[model samples]
Target: MKYINKKIIFTFLLVLLMNGCLGIIPNKDSVTRKDTTTNIESSIYKKYNRHTDTTYYSHNNLFGKNISIYWTKKKKEKSYARIKFSYLGSRWIFFNEVTLVNAAGSRISFHIKSTDISTNVVSDRIVSEKANFLLSKVDIISLKKLFNSPSVDLRLSGKSHKDYALSESEIKSLFEILSYNP
Candidate 1:
């Protein structure tokens, strides 16, 4: 009888020790360490993906409207264009700019220097040599109007051209979508 009691007691103690080691009871104060290095690395990679090769713009009081835009190379032989209405100046004139991206991963930027209604100037210049075109006088006004219009489209010109043109409305819509998803 004594042997039977000892055997039962030994089994109970073993079960109890196994349950404790297995965390059957929640340890509220236990310092459970997690290896977050992988998660941190993934998050860092995701940040770059989030803003990869994209241009962003916001309200420019000079343009009298709010706008956003984005563009990327559409094909090996083609470039991308984006335009956005930044703001309307005090004179109720719209301000905006156009951004171009070529298949070679270059950005071409242009903006309005002056408008008929206001002296407020909105200007943009390519920060990199990857951009291979210059903004002409007519191109500036045309780009601004494009963004001002309700519809958006891209029209490419020039032989061996790296220049791209976009309207204001199109730019804004693209940025709006990007901002929403981001």
Candidate 2:
């Protein structure tokens, strides 16, 4: 009886070990086929001149206060691009200029100035502008990378300027705008 019981226990342990090993070894045939399908899709998207749409937002801590900025691709032209963006909150009062530029030396810029009431002390103005191809690609991933990259020496009256990462939703909206062929 003892020998029989031992045999049964040993068989159960062997079965359990085999099941565990099977779980760890992935079915290579299925994984390889799935990867092949994804590669083909990616290649197709690239071949068709398909541009993705994206939106990006960023924030900064300036003078102990938070200032938020956003950029979105609004439209595209045969030889140019159009983008819309906003500087949120009270800090908007300080901003004085905004611009967008491309490689062909085309530029579009906007400016504003706040009039001081009491002390007659005007703040160091705020300016926002897009330069280089980076501004043209305003998707979430690219925007995040842009903020992380080196500064482009954008300043307003000696005040340093910087960009921050945008939210996921903002990136999606920007992509939508860019993807519209019209």
Candidate 3:
């Protein structure tokens, strides 16, 4: 009987691993400063088993500031690219000052019509912008040559004074993070 119970437990663990039932949940805290994840939405993370590999890149024009970016997929129907900007001195992601150009040569502007914003002070007030603009697939054939190469120049242009671009490594990491199925 004891042997049978042990086997059952092993089987259960295997199933959980295979189905991705064991994953860190994505939440506001997941992308926040390097501490205090108390505000995380554990229920959603428990339900979906999201992979919590967040990518960080330094912000342009903001000294000593880095932006945290992460990807999330809900019910396999909605995919999101969340970008958070914060600084200790004085800098924030002004909605009108940011623009994103995808690999398809499409220039998309940030829409402030409706979004969920939460304020908490850990390192600084993080301005999070979760957009579904990256939900669909894009033509990455043009990026094959630039794969994992951090020699390309990417600049952000719009109504914002800040400046930053995805390094080659960052672009590769972005692709890897978004390649998730769930």
TM-score of each: 0.19, 0.24, 0.35
Give lDDT tens digits, candidate 3, residues 56-144. 22212112222333445545255554454432212333333334454555443444333432323332322332222232343222233
Which ranges of candidate 3 are over 4 A from the true structure? Answer: 1-89, 101-108, 114-134, 137-160
Candidate 2 to truth, TM = 0.24
Q: Could you give me the TM-score of model 1 versus the true structure?
A: 0.19
Best by lDDT: 3
Superposed by TM-score, candidate 1 places the C-alpha of residue 175 at a distance from the truth, in angstroms, of 12
In angstroms, the error of model 2 at 95 is: 5.4
lDDT of 2 by residue, 61-156 (tens): 111111123333323523223333333221323435444332233333434334411112222332222222223444433433333322211222
Candidate order, TM-score descending: 3, 2, 1
Q: What would you estimate as the lDDT of candidate 3?
A: 0.36
**lDDT ranking from best to worst?**
3, 1, 2
lDDT scores of the candidates, listed in order:
0.32, 0.30, 0.36
**Candidate 1, poorest ten consecutive residues by summed lDDT:** 123-132
lDDT of 1 by residue, 40-144 (tens): 221111112334544332222112222333333322333233433332211222323335442333444454444411323322211111112233445444544
Clashing pairs in model 2, backbone N/Cα/C closer than 3 A: 53-175, 54-174, 54-175, 55-170, 55-171, 55-174, 57-166, 96-112
* TM-score of model number 3: 0.35
